[model samples]
Target: MHTGDVTARLAELLLGARCPGCGAPGMGACAACAAGLRRMQPFGVGGLPDGLPPVTAAGAYADTLRAVLLAAKERNALGLLPLLGGRLAAAVARLVLDAGGIPSLVLVPVPSASAQVAARGVDLTTSIARTAAARLRSAGLAVEVLRGLVLARRPEDQAGLTRIQRLANRAGAFRAVGPPPSGPVVVVDDIVTTGATLAEAVRACEVGDRQVIGAAVVAATMRGGGAR
Candidate 1:
């Protein structure tokens, strides 16, 4: 069974079927929460971190979307993958179109530290990326997922850091392993608060002599903030 399947099953056994967005009783998402997710009509997100590429988001990081993402991150809400994965797939399509219709694509997930994976019992980024890739492939798009990037060094937790501090902490923090990604690449992550992490992923691809076409996120913090 997939790790997501195991996690979701465990959650159901321990806590019953509950909506990741509203905590109402249901599998994956309750009908109301499912209705809450949709593609942003204007998909482009502004104010990227320096050196970050043009990107798209499934939704702003607020409301029901915020609840769902945090559920997948903090709780074992893997049952919600179908919903979240759909959101990510829409974002990737928008990004590909913005990049002038890339012929084919590889999705590279930003790695979560081994410690985080151990503590959480799931790699949220990779799981979601694979889910999105599966959805894209079913739609007849050529999509692949590569998950070989690792953090070169550990940085302090980013919760309270200023934008500049985040950039400093993650600078040169990622490197690709097991040969580098080739063909057009799109870096995938669950969320983007300041884009520090995503920029580093792009840099890692550059270091490996690859260029990221753009990035796609399940959601992004839409509040105003500038990156240095």
Candidate 2:
């Protein structure tokens, strides 16, 4: 098993398998948080303010969800990514099904800057996408992970950047290493703040034999607030 699995099991044992966001002890998601998150309907984006693929987010980017996302992405709390990524993957899978049919899902994680991944001791989004792929496979879906894509530039952090600025910064920053494997490619990210990053990733993958299908993220900051 991967480190994510080990951490997830440990978290479940220590936290009573509770929803990390709301402190609902005893289940992966408590009724309240689940209801709230679910209420943040999976909205379609032409792309984030950035230029990523159409994104489907599990929840908004604040409050309980924010805490969970920070823990997973910033604090080296790897366990939460599986929980969060799995939810996003499920939502994405639904969209795939609704669109027509399920193609072999190839998870292409949006690459983080090498410096940031080095600081974190791992590629956060890649790891989360891997876990999500595993979960999707376990549910009897065909899936695989491809990290053949690489970054050609390191754009500045997008925290306060406007959508246009973010898009301009990320333009042409990604490049594919080789021909993509045969399947529908879905770019995965931990969060879709503006979407500049994800869009570039999708564009890079489209250069090869890959069919760009969609994108998914654990959370997205709503224009107004919260996920809903």
Candidate 3:
């Protein structure tokens, strides 16, 4: 097969011709699913999940948005990158423009715990952040991604934990891998559940005189497990 043919076949195999939202089998989510996903209003700084900074979510973490995020983060749905990536970039842009107050910005993704990375075989949050940063750069914005943060100590997953519980679990968990960057740094993540993880990450990023600009995420759990 020619290169173009091979590429097309790969796209078909990866993205399929159906929608993930409705199982209609044509380029993933169908029009209804797409519309449902869009109904999730993008929200700004409020009660965010742990290990993040002042954050924004593209939509509530339910229904189509939840499905898309799980598919991307757990099921290895690389095809959804363009969709989720666009949202992530939009969140980053909003933070940089409003909360961070920095013209040129740097994106720093909160490092997934080592065990989680080993399980997934990919850093989903970091991947999304890199994609988002590229989109920002394409729009003539100065942006760079620096994966210079890591969990100082491994901890339990915050899945069922309360916000306070999550906060305690993630407190003092992150540390810089080296001297941090000079430009404003926005901590990026895939979701905000209880604002605990994001808070811990913000504290770590702000340590050592590094200016933590803000936080951004693709989604946030809404009205679930006490998420505001």
Candidate 4:
């Protein structure tokens, strides 16, 4: 088969018959969508779970950006890593600067449930966290990807769950492992809906006195009025 034919078939297998970012037929993540993922406007999130560090989203989860994120996350569009990772790095940069003279950043990704990982055959959040860390390092920031957090217990899926239900579902979902981090920590996730998961991550890290400076996400849902 021709290269374009192979690509189109791949897109069909992974993300239907059209581009996720624009629904363009016979394409897998069009170039225009890749370019659209570059800009990131970090903003503070509100209504966080208590004891959760302040969180920032690279951008609102809407329009082309949402499509791009879902493309990379759900549809296995690995080619969009630089564009998506660049935006995540921007959010992490803002957190580091706001934190003031933080020598290095330790990124702890919110762990995926074992079942989910098995079903997907890939750990998407961890990949994004690593990508974000690399981007930060390229921009002259001290960065480390710490797989410090793990899922303590399987919880019901957050989809269709109410805000309170989400908070309860993730209350004890995460725990920190390995030696205590010597420096500050920043939890990273692909998306934040009600901030419950991020909060759980913060609480897990703090169980051992590790200072969680902040959290960063690729995008956040505006319906909860969290990301401003």
Candidate 5:
């Protein structure tokens, strides 16, 4: 294990973990909550942004999954990384394999602003992408995480924003950095709400001739069955 990984595990152990889903003590997420989270079916969100890749999510953003994501992103609950990452990996695997399985693929995580990373004490999306890459590798699929997209400028947080507001805020907000990944790319994010962020990410990647196969997320907010 890397030194950082070892240190993080030690920290989680010393902190006396609590299950984010049910507030049960003694584990980051208890087995029951884990099982509940695993009861996920991949689905797409309504009103997807224009040019957004076909997206898939491990589950709906509700109940145990929502709680776990909140704890992981808002509270620095690093212990939840493995569980969340595993779900993300599974979602991505399904997307790629259903398309006939590539020999290797790249995961492009949506970038978080520097301010957000500082406030959270971690780059949440990148960390999850790294973990998800590891899980995919272990499952015998070659995977690489290419952080090729960067924010052109920091924008206001998406919280409380309507769909149009979000689309406006995120449009033209990302740019490709350095050489783009050479293989099929799957944009990864922690959540897919209106998909404005992922759409921008896909746009940025495509700017460099990178072929984005699809997108994957840990969860998606429920919406009407058809395009809104």
Candidate 6:
């Protein structure tokens, strides 16, 4: 195992498993916190960027979901992976059913920057995508995860950028790492903020002639009148 993995495991063992949402000691999220996360809803980008594929989120990025995502992404709260991944799987299932129930689909996660991954010791979105793929396979759907996208260059941090600024900054920021899949490609992401990153991902896949059906995300931030 990598030193980082060993350290994370050691920390988990020492700290014991506590709910990221409630801090209650147990395995993974507590029942009450899990119940709160059960409220999955479809969301759309309000000021949807051009070239962005149709995207649907499983739930709003707030409350317990927000806490859990932050814990998983920023704090190395690995226990929340299963719950978040299950939510992503549910979203992918819905999208497949809406698209006439394809027998199989390829899921491509939006890649994180190399520097960020080095610092975090894990690629949060990719890890969740893998877990989501496993859940989908268990449910009898043929799911394939393609790590096809990579950062063409590191862009500025997107913490507080406006939609237009984000779009400009992320333009041409991603490129496909290999030949794109022939079947439908669904970009999976942890969050859809301004839809810029997902839009760039779709563009990268299309560069290799991949048919991007849509995108699936764990959560989305509601803006304007709310997601459609």
Q: What is the C-alpha RMSD of each candidate to the true structure, in Å?
A: 5.2, 6.0, 4.5, 3.6, 5.3, 5.8
Candidate 1 residue 24 Cα shift, in angstroms, is 2.5
TM-score of 4: 0.86
Q: Write the per-residue lDDT of candidate 2 for residues 155-217, one digit (tens) a residue.
A: 776667777787788889989887768878887777776667777888888875578778887
> For residues 134-218, could you state the per-residue lDDT of candidate 1 as single tens digits?
9888888899898768899887788888778888999888988877656778988888888889888899987887668888888
| True-structure Cα RMSD, model 1 | 5.2
lDDT by residue (tens digit), candidate 6, 1-228: 876555545656887756677776555677788987776665544457766666778888887898899888888777788899889987888788777788888999999988778988888888889999999999999889999998888889888888888888888999998876867899999988788888888988889788899999998877641111
Worst 10 residues of 4 by lDDT: 25-34
TM-score of each: 0.88, 0.78, 0.82, 0.86, 0.88, 0.87
Which ranges of candidate 2 are over 4 A from the true structure? 1-20, 23-41, 46-53, 224-228
Off by over 4 Å in 3: 1-18, 30-41, 48-53, 224-228
Flag regions of model 6 displaced more than 4 Å.
Answer: 1-17, 43-46, 225-228
Q: Which candidate do you rate higher for lDDT, 1 or 3?
A: 1
Question: Considering lDDT, which of the candidate structures 1 and 6 is the better prediction for this target?
Answer: 6
In candidate 5, stretches whose alpha carbon ends up further than 4 angstroms from where it belongs are 1-17, 225-228
- Clash pairs of candidate 4? none
lDDT of the structure predicted as candidate 5: 0.82
Model 2: C-alpha RMSD to truth?
Answer: 6.0
The sequence of per-residue lDDT tens digits that candidate 3 reaches over residues 100-184 is 3566888888887666677877777888888898898898888899887888888786777777787888878898777868788
lDDT of 4 by residue, 93-120 (tens): 8787777757787998889878767766
Shift in Å, residue 170, candidate 5: 0.7
The lDDT of each candidate is 0.80, 0.71, 0.74, 0.79, 0.82, 0.81
Q: Report the lDDT tens digits of candidate 5 across residue range 1-228.
A: 876555545655787556789866555787789987777766654568666667888888888999999999888888899899988988898787678878899999999988889998888888998998999999899899988888898777888888888878888999988876778999999998877788788888899788999999988887642111
